[model samples]
Target: MRTEFNWHLTAWKSLGRPSPGDIIWETELLNHSELVMRKRAYQNSTLYATFPRDPCDSYVHCGGNGNSVLNSSLICQCLKRFVPGSLENWNLKDFLKGCVRRKPFSCRNDGFAKYLQLKLLDTTHNWINKSKNLVECMAKCLSNCSCSAYTDIDVRGRGSSSAIWFE
Candidate 1:
């Protein structure tokens, strides 16, 4: 079944105050994820910003464990040691199935993969400890059978939250 969703646009001059602008526009397309603009008397609409400025900017564009590469026809690829869950679907430009580990995880030898310069996954339901360093975080995550990913919240090398996720 096909599901329909709606996205509403609104402008605010200040907190809880609506703007009485003459025109406001926001649009999304295949090439451009989003475009927003505003217009007033005798003037062309001024574009605010174009979303997905980079191919990677689009939310989960490459699905889990996939990387979105800019300026490439083959935009998405599975991470190292992972393979497309559905190879046929991936080749057909459908990545919703995401990627899967090439081999089943072994607790005795399993370890986290270091992905640099990545926008971490959602943390709403993940575990977090503010007083842990990266080494401590890794140790904690490694001890848990369910832990899937882990990282130090602050990237500056200073002590920060240890964020961990479970599958």
Candidate 2:
């Protein structure tokens, strides 16, 4: 018997347990929806791995205000309504400095974009409003000129948590 866990599963019944192997095999999907399997490691001597989880799992892997989309050729991409800071870098595979707003926020005419299936970013520059509902949280975030994004994060027992980020 092998204990295998899959980190990404779109549905429950669709789940398939990985087989136990001293040699680990992992798949990394590229931009064109092509799947490439790479031998990650041998579970001998020590068991450990590296960061970014994969090339696509790094914070701002696509640069500032940019997102690293999984299974895409241009993994790092500016969020909706934004443009890359350096188009040359973006095309040349250098995603260090992420993105810039397409239109400057008047603060009065700005709206929030909804995103799904993402890992929580680092909370170093976040503001937590525990009591606010999603609408209230959006309003709270809207008042601050620096608030770049907001979300209602669920906290199992404690309920939903309002998290806002300043890019």
Candidate 3:
């Protein structure tokens, strides 16, 4: 059988289980995020597979405002203008506490910082304005105090829409 596991922002490409003729399949949710699967053959042999090959592939792996630093020994880093939410946990290499803004935000004085080549966070709780361009998107987010981040709907396309995060 073929199966797929999906989340708000990402999904596993696909998983193909063994043919049913002589195999039995079982799946286990290893933790809050990881999933493991095993196939047992009638011959007393078993094959196993695990989802999310790395920490970066897990949902909210680095927590909010934390960027998963890929291709390095480092697992997470706070975004520009932000600091680790918990310095003690950060020192221990535990990023679950995520990040916090270095300075308090003031609606009129705060401005957005440009970030390039980032894999966006989960957008399940965001707002999408299809009619807004990049500039207009920035204005909208700026107008709303709750806005945290904004980006083009299609980063690699014509950018005809905007998606804004409010968390």
Best by TM-score: 3
TM-score of each: 0.69, 0.64, 0.71
The true-versus-predicted C-alpha distance at residue 61 of model 1, in Å, is: 1.2
Weakest 10 consecutive residues, lDDT, candidate 1? 1-10
Question: In terms of TM-score, how similar is model 2 to the real structure?
Answer: 0.64
lDDT, candidate 2, 1-167, per-residue tens: 11353332122222384454333333333321222223334433332343345767655566667777778877877878889898888889898877888998777787787777666666768878777767788878888888888888765645457888985
lDDT of 2 at 52: 41
Candidate 2 at residue 36, lDDT?
Answer: 28
Q: Evaluate model 3: give its lDDT.
A: 0.74
lDDT of 3 by residue, 1-167 (tens): 12475422222334564324433233444444455554444557554566778788786777778888788677898899899999999888888989899999887887888898777767666888888888889988998998989999766678789989986
Which candidate number maximizes lDDT?
1
- Rank list by lDDT: 1, 3, 2
Candidate 3: residue 143 lDDT (0-100): 88
